[model samples]
Target chain A: MDLLPQLTQYAFSGLSTGAIYALIGLGFAIIYNSTGIINFAQGEFVMLGGVLTHFFLMVLKFPLVVSMAVAILVATAIGVAFERLTIRPLKRPTPLSMVIITIGGSIFIRGVAMLIWGKDTHSLPPFSGNEPLVIAGATVMPQHLWIFGLTLLVIAANKYFFYYTISGKAMRACSYNRTAASLVGIDVRRMVFLSFAISSAMGAMAGIIIAPLTMTAYDVGVMLGLKGFCAAIIGGMSSGFGTVLGGLLLGLLESLGAGLISSGYKDAIAFIILLLILFIRPQGLFSKAQTERV
Target chain B: MKRFVFSCSLFVLILTCSALCGASQPIKIGALFSVTGPPSFLGEPERNAAQMVADSINKSGGIKGRQVQLISYDTGGDATKAVQLANRLIKDDKVVAIIGPSTTGETMAVMPVVEKAGVPLISCAAGRKITEPVNRWVFKTAQNDNLAVAKIYEYLQKKKLNRVALLTVSDGFGSSGREQLKAQAATHGISVLYDETYGPKDTDMTAQLTKIRGTQAQALICWGTNPGPAVVARNAKQLGLKMPLFMSHGVSSKKFIELAGDAAEGVMLPSGKVIVADVLPDSDPQKKWLMAFVKEYQKLHKVEGDHFGGHAWDAMMLLKGALEKGDDLPATIAANLEKSRAFHGIGGSFTYTPVDHAGLAKDAFVLVEVKNRDWVLVK
Candidate 1:
């Protein structure tokens, strides 16, 4: 194997994994921007997506597309219910308190999922086929293409929603200044609710697309959620294209490091880069530093 | 207040009466299994099988007309938790003997606790270190990992595949297997071209496999539990790596086939004969026992029996035999276990001496392959 093809293989696999992180990072960024709180339960939504789709397809014998849609919809519903049940009831919710609540919700959801689905991992069939396409001595799965294309489409739609739609504009306003946004007659609570809905749906979609390659289980969310959080931190939680770039960079570094260095240090490479970015560029690689944080 | 005092006195009197009258107390035994965490696949079946054995013993009128009482705890695959639970079982439960602490790491963690307490433990984990140094109180039923590696290497040698790549998980089972693979490579006339490790929770192994693809290795041997090895299989297929793939006994179950999907096809491994019990000839001494256990376990759990459950069955049955032959005291049971010879069990026939705690030989393992999503004994 020549160095070039090997590098190409690394980059190709990295980009697909990066796309998953980007999806999850985008979810974290959305909820953070809207409610000024990091929802740790964001990962559970991703787990729900894959597990529910698996249940629908394998157990219920539903078609792939219908199973995916129902899974995403149910996850979004759970997101909304989570907000109504856990988040909206707080009388004086501090940022730390809300973060802790999300962590609790994450554990609760994970436990319930474990009870419903056994500890064994479940795999989803690849959307296209199992055959790999070779380009310039590098092999790529059809699922990777699906991941790349879907991630791009998602980012573009997210951009349109946040910039062009009125509700999305109002959510941004809440992120900027909640009191001011409420004073201007925008229903801030609705924006917060909407943010949860959008993020959970996005997270589930990401889980579904990546399930074929990574295999899905109840506990996979912990590592993946932390990695997405790293991506969000690296991208400065921009809720835009910044997080996408952050994920791509993290994935590539991890792959190349594993290939060139020792595979044992693969996970360490991600954390090292995360710590370096936090120390050097806390605002993230792609986001502009904000003058004030709400 | 007067009525409450009278009732308390009455309760104490009844307790004393029952204690005095109950001469034939049940024999208490403790078990520790990782029933719910990452390694639950190994632990769940093991727990079920152990419980099944205990129930059957009690049903048939337990050791010396004393009913057997099994107290099982779930360690969740955590070594620290295993140690804590071991203390609770020994000090609080007052169990004469202990079984399990499912994985090698947990088994190793609890070994000192059992040794200090003078309790005999028959672990289900396959790591060689569990019984290698021959702790006074510890024995295991699973075949040593060196035997599994030797079985694999012999097959590889027969195929003339001299050079191989190794990918292992960096946990107890894997690190132990990696050590055995490295140690026994020379005598088997095989050389390792590349060696790499991935975390137990890692989702991808393409990077590691890609590095192996660059090597002159003719085959890749992966040693790890489910999901990790499954990912390696998928990654190898995605990379179109045209080399034979071999796996450790950690993945001798159907769950591995389901997790890896199509990638599991043509994957070969070394496994306990319990996995291929149905195909074994009648002349095989262990075949009848294996078939009976497979049927009984499936009837109870409604699932196919694998090597993991077989390990627990061996441990419990070994303990039962000792209890039936000797006094119910831990010391006597330990002595009885040591005196055992040519005792047939699921993993293999055991012949425990004072020197060798893990009594099975290299022939305990048979080479098996995954074909069409089922295990086929390689001829």
Candidate 2:
């Protein structure tokens, strides 16, 4: 059989999944850009958002809208508190130490989540019905549309905040040069915390939207977080827009691989692509070429 | 000097009390299952059933006038964790016997530990390897894939479905079933038209199903756990491929219906007759036991118990029966289990011999079809 149609189907599936990866990648990008440290707990933020929403809406019988709002708010507060307590104290520590701290934070958060929610897979009702919409002999779930649309909206909002808003510009300045930003009267520490808060909120939003599609469990965050980190790295970890692009590409690759090849190797394809990209173009697909600094 | 004497006297008294308590203590059985991880669906149900059996047995004055205490640990579906838990249960908890570390991988990992400890282990999982290469202490209560596959072949032969396409998950359970089907297909004079494989977490199977649709197979044989069967049913409906679908007993759970929805209709699979029979003939010895278990389980859990729960109940009952007869808890339990003959269980009448640990016959399963979203006996 000709592989074209199969490849196309794979592409459609990949794009849907890639949209989710991009959202997660963008969250990583936002936090890394501001804090100069990878927030390993970013995926757990997504998991927390989804699981908390499930508890509030389904188990507690709260209205869906109210539960979602509360989930986001709680996730944002946690993001801020995490930065203020764990990350803020490690400001003067080595970058390696900060990275290790974030990893530790991720483990701690996952443990607490497991203890609180137990390890059952929890799912919420899809925002739309579960019917798959067919287009050109390919079917896509309605929830995939939500994931893609939300990714776009968040990206646009992030762009406007960073480029147009004064607070956003201050954060940007701090990312570029902390000493210069501080000299110019920007509160560098507060900006760092704000970046974490925003990034965490985005991560949580991604979790809430995708939870209905994939279901959520305590340990689900580890893989998602790793994949999102890979996406960010492949897209140039410093560039938020590039991270989104990288995530979409990774998602499409995975889906196509599952369709044409073995479904068992679907996850492996992403890491293979990641390794190849790093070997050939270490600067990433969209990042500016930079000389090594001594 | 007076204070020291008083403390010494208190210590001696505590030691004496503990020794007395230990001498007349209840029998402790270690139960391990995956309370966390992916297989929690199977493991959680097994755990609940095990606890229910233990509670019921104790309420009935336990085995031969001594209470039975169950100490359970979560294996998390990890082999390493299974070993650690088995060690803890044997060495630390000092349980006389152990029930499970459900799944083939975990069971195999903990087999050496249980064997070394000289404790009898009766597993609830269905991997035949647990009983083979034969450790004297290890016995499985659930029917292995060989029997399940043979039943499938029998059903297909009876229906005159000579041409079949197979789709299976590429996991240990799926691969084992596939091997059995392939081996038995020629014996039954059935033609294998097509074969496809998918992973456990796969959400879509349209591509595989589409390929299978082109084949002139009379029926589709799917081998996997929950979402796999559900996905197949949904995709088959979407492709408008109308043919009988046969599944292994692994998919025999209520969650299959919840996941598959309307697509679950007309799907036939093998299930233990004790669980599927709406009205058992009064002549059958297991009828009362099955009904009582069904009623109590439903009353307490507010949900119908499946073959998994029934299997757990049978395993516990076997242990109870053994404990009642055996003078030395471990050695006697093992001997009694081996000598078990015509024990009426919720699954079927079981008779364990030295060669076979799973005492029930392949005929114990009745072909069941989902009609109007409820299981109906087909044979």
**Candidate number achieving the greatest DockQ relative to the actual structure:** 1
Which candidate wins on lDDT? 1
Q: What does the i-RMS of model 1 come to?
A: 1.2
Looking at model 2 chain A, report the run of 10 residues with the lowest lDDT sum. A285-294
Q: Chain B of candidate 2 versus the native chain B: what TM-score?
A: 0.92
List the pairs of residues colliding in candidate 2: none
Candidate maximizing TM-score: 1
Candidates in order, TM-scores: namely: 0.95, 0.87
The whole-model lDDT of each prediction reads 0.90, 0.80
* Tens-digit lDDT track of model 1 for B96-214: 99999788889989999999999999998877788879998999998888889999999989999999999999988889899999999999999999999999888888888988999
* Candidate 1 CAPRI classification by DockQ: medium
Give DockQ: model 1. 0.77
On a 0 to 1 DockQ scale, where is model 2? 0.25
